[model samples]
Target: MTTVIFVHGTGIRQREYNDTFEIIEQKIHAQRPDIKVAPCLWGALGAKFNENRASVPLEDGTLALSQGEEDADIVLWGQLYRDPLYELRLLSLKPIKSRNPFGEKPGDILQSRVASLTPTLELEANLQEAGIAEIFAQARDTVIRSQPYKGALLTVSESDLSEYYAAIARAIAAQAMFISELQEKFPPILTDAQLRDKVVELLTLALTEAKLGLGGWLLKPVLGLAQHGGTNYIRRNRVELTDKISPMPGDILLYQTRGEKIRQFIQEQIAQAEPPVVLLAHSLGGIACVDLLVQQQLSGVELLVTVGSQAPFLYEINALYSLEYGQLLPEHFPEWLNIYDLRDFLSYVGNKIFPERVQDVLVDSRQPFPRSHGAYWTNAKTWEAIISRLP
Candidate 1:
């Protein structure tokens, strides 16, 4: 029976690690009951942040987000960017404060625009892109069915049809983009942020064709959706930013500088494992495993599975501890299985750089980068690939 050793990624606390690791344990149990799973968890030995430490205040005094703030911001953007329907959903849920029954209702205009949109979208959404058509139908159905839509339909009496039509257009566009569905059918041609912008542009044309005459100006609110989300998120998680997320750089720094102890610990785990071992590592843990396996071959290790790891990138830059820029992987290195998600910016493919030595497998987490990075273990395909290679 093969011994599947599990290694965790960076910035992971004990509880989070335990929950993710448990999923692996259970998945392996269901698939190959004879196999044994081991832990090479190195987070405790890696870097940590102090929650009590207050963040350094900016000159204006708003706490600067952790060094990882930009990355965190990208994650927030990813949330809004990936889900085209998010903006409309938020608008549909808002309380209707004022309505003019004499005036056109936003829902009425939305329904009309959707009706106009159907034939044009049918060409693409219904045929070339059936998923988009489904999303379009669902989005329209959801809004029209909402109590707010019903209330707005009844109560709207204002002549200022501007806001009503504007909101309607945005909601329709946001719901119609349904980016995740598009990505599954086609290779992601644009980043999440880029995709959101492109969809908005397309939405304006679609609405114009449908005769709503809703231009980019009316759909402007969609552009700020991510910013609005980030502002609210920061306000809610101020403590988490200063205390936990900010210290993530510490772990990266620690692994790069004080790495011997981390690598040694992994070696020890390998030594103790039964024969036919697999070094299953994630993120920084994958880096350490690559570093250790490069320095000297441990007898039992037969496979090196890395999920969302930066090892290949590090080696290309000559930053990996054990291997230099010009050197090929040591002859003793185990067969490598590197798994990555296209949405995960931190995850790299090794096949391009390492050729036949590495196998790069892609899994769709249906999530943006931040969530995608951590979501590997939960993706069924990640295990399917790993299990297929298990001895």
Candidate 2:
């Protein structure tokens, strides 16, 4: 039996992941009665997936899951919160090298210092209370204003709040590494000063990498509703477009950079599965699935389908030759059809996708949508089209 793996996206909560998987499964099963489907939960929150001594100690001391929990294979899919790791790296005792010679606002400087350490719920609340939120708003405004004055712009610029969150993630991973090193070299009962030194060292490493200096490469530009003007911009407009089928857990941002971690977990899962699997990913999850397929590592995936997906992950592959370099090429889709809705902001339009090598179907989504992001399976026509295309 083929296993369908569901990888979730950012701002997704545990219960929402479960419910979406259930809805998708029921629809898929009704069409292809024999398939076995499952949802994989990865670390959407920073602390939840800490590979540190603290988590182990806490689990051993207080609460722990019972045995036999491994009945089904576990895969950490979607985005992982990496802000904690970045934060750890930023918090090293060594004074962080300031790229901005003018120096950041006092609150910005202080919040960055604290955010680079562990994420305590109270610490976050305190940062907001202490005017860091205002500092960030001012920073955002400064960046916008400095658009014309290129030279005066801060050398270490983080374009989005997501980047700051990512910094927090870097801290967590760095902390875990620091603990691992401590365990390896030092004996039990380390002095407070020793711990302080370690924290400084880690933070230094994180700050160095996070520096957005001239000629530094940019990863994926944070894609979402734009801040203003465009129909796709969701941030500036406080419009709630969620479509609900039931009373399920709402979405949440667990930690920064959770996307990358989730993607890695899914890649590992696909690689290790005993039986061939089918990856059905929606929106950003679809991008993660395409990433796995293009790696040429998953020999077991019979088919891969992306619905209402962002194009870059699949379009850049070498398999689909019809696409042009830097011009949005469509290539090497894994033995299945890719579906898009016209009004869905996640999916793109235009360019000739090879009908023979890789199938592409576009659906009109201007009609009432169930949700702003995930209406692919909920719509009857979309489900029918998907069922027809399955192998």
* Model 2, span 1-391: residue lDDT tens: 7777776654456777788888998999987988778675653422333343332223233333322212100100001122212222222322333454575543364345544434245434433433232233332233223322122122234333233433333233233334434456332212333342333334333434443211211121121111122223222222232222111222223222243555577877776664568777766566556555554456677777777765443364532222344542235445755777766766743235433544667776555553545766677877777677655
Task: Assess the local accuracy of residue 4 in candidate 1 as a C-alpha lDDT between 0 and 100.
Answer: 89
TM-score of model number 1: 0.56
Stretches of candidate 2 exceeding 4 Å from the true structure: 43-260, 272-274, 313-333, 349-356, 365-372
Name the weakest run of 10 consecutive residues (lDDT summed) in model 1.
Answer: 209-218
Over 1-391, each residue of candidate 1 has an lDDT whose tens digit, in order, gives 6898998888888888788878999998888999999877787887653543445333233554443334333443354446534434444444555765587666577457656664454344322232344455666566556554554444333343444444454454444544434556432323344544344445555554333332243244433543455554555456555556644577789989999999998888888888899988998889999999989878689999999999999989989889898788878899999999998989999988888999999999999868888888789999899889998
- Top-lDDT candidate index: 1
Worst 10 residues of 2 by lDDT: 71-80
**Which regions of candidate 1 are displaced past 4 Å?**
49-239
